[model samples]
Target: MAKLNINVRSFSYKKGIPTDPTGNGGGFVFDCRGILNPGRKEEFKTQTGRDEAVIKYLETETKIALFLEGVFQVIDISIEDYIQRGFENLEINFGCTGGQHRSVYSADTTAKYIENKFPEVQVTVQHVVQEEKNWINEAY
Candidate 1:
């Protein structure tokens, strides 16, 4: 089996509904937005580069790396063991209010992290609610 790194969370909330990782089996899903601050849901009106929200997401991931407690613990166990035993696939999910900004950034960040950490693993970023290219083109 090909080594699979699944990113389940949608790119934006509109399309990025997270499924039960347990149901999918033993793979780990690191929910940067869900576990760290589930209650602080807010809609970002304007996307700012290097904004507080983005910083928060990055901070959350870093924190998870340090302790490996809570939800992150599960991922740590799965990936570490899988790497040892020569496992084929792994899955990760990052969720946020809209999935567009925070979740997308988180997923991308995590994917890059893992790939660099483990060169053998294949990483894929699946955006749930992909923005329309036309809209972006029009805006630009």
Candidate 2:
């Protein structure tokens, strides 16, 4: 079985965090609302975090890089520990006010990080709010 590194999700605080469909329980839930929101600006209102403009805004204008650095450190421990213990499945969630910008960026970035850093484990991302709208997920 493929051991899950994280169940990263971008969620709205109003809607609450998403449950793990991975069937295994317990993981990190990072709140991205504390980061500066680009959604407040009219230019970025319609853009999701995946967009280059919003990505640049988050990386340059906000503390998201620092926040994610700390996140990677903490998650690295769990990944290492899980491997040591012979475990499968871990959970991780990222939440913001709308789940469109900060949370989505964080979740996607973290998944990519794990895929590159670990290379053996599986990484999954769920954009809770965006998926409800226009995003269609593909095999990762």
Candidate 3:
């Protein structure tokens, strides 16, 4: 059993995501920013976003096979190197425009993917921009 962590801010940028495994390295951190739709009219602050058709296409059964293949390429290289190390953590970041809809959705999707693939590992989602602890505390 091992531990892998993925951090996704949104499907907009890859500021926090990590590059693919280069062997003898840590786990993976998928950049979900590619999945975000910039919106019809580019605004400084707003949630006009959507997933690109290309991304949806890649997630399909056929493409997912290839996608997973690439993901596993890193995983395999990492696992072989780190299995003896005991544990590994992958932090994936999904960033979108407003960090509400697309980012949240991508994070959930990535977490789900990790859970399905590595059932023994722990998967967690952290909605940094959208999750407002301040608001919750104020309301309480």
Candidate 4:
């Protein structure tokens, strides 16, 4: 049998709950509201987390690093067990007020981390609020 590791979905709370694209429910949800919000600033008001400026602000000026560490620790345990059990579906949603800034960043960060750490897993990331609607799927 082919090994299927993980599937992740990132979305805004405004868009409603993110369901597994493959039809599974009961995934993890992380709220990014606790982190320092960059959206309050005038310059960052129009920007999303994918932008360089927003990235810098979240990484350097906020507690996002530590926040993500805790997120990873919790998710890692679940992911490891999922892989062992031959589970093929997992959904992770990051939610913020606007789903444009903090939530988007958290989703992207988490997806990238899983992709890098567990090459056996397939990772999918979606930014629901962006005009272009970014989607990334990485499989190995």
Among these predictions, the greatest lDDT belongs to 2
Candidate numbers sorted by lDDT from highest down? 2, 4, 1, 3
lDDT of 2 by residue, 1-140 (tens): 54645567888898987887767767889999889998888888888889899999999999999999999999999998887777788888999988888999999999999889988787778888889977543211
**Candidate 4, poorest ten consecutive residues by summed lDDT:** 131-140
Model 1 residue 51 distance off true place after TM-score fit, in angstroms: 8.6
For model 2, the superposed segments whose C-alpha errors exceed 4 Å read: 136-140
For model 3 the local lDDT of residue 124 reads 61
- The better-scoring model by lDDT among 2 and 3 is 2
lDDT of each: 0.51, 0.85, 0.46, 0.79
State in Å the error of residue 37, model 4: 1.4
Candidate 2 matches the true fold with a TM-score of 0.91
- Model 1 clash pairs? 3-88, 10-16, 11-99, 11-128, 12-99, 12-100, 13-98, 13-99
In candidate 2, which residue pairs get closer than 3 Å at backbone N, Cα or C atoms, i.e. clash?
A: none
Candidate 1 structure lDDT: 0.51
Total clashing pairs in model 1: 8
Per-residue accuracy of model 4 over 32-68 as CA lDDT, tens digit each:
9898888788788777888899999999999999999
lDDT for residue 42 in candidate 4, whole number 0-100: 78
Residue lDDT tens for model 1, 10-125: 44344444564436564544444543432233433344212576456546644534422354445656777776776766667665554545555556656666677667776676
Give candidate 1 regions above 4 Å deviation: 1-26, 34-74, 131-140
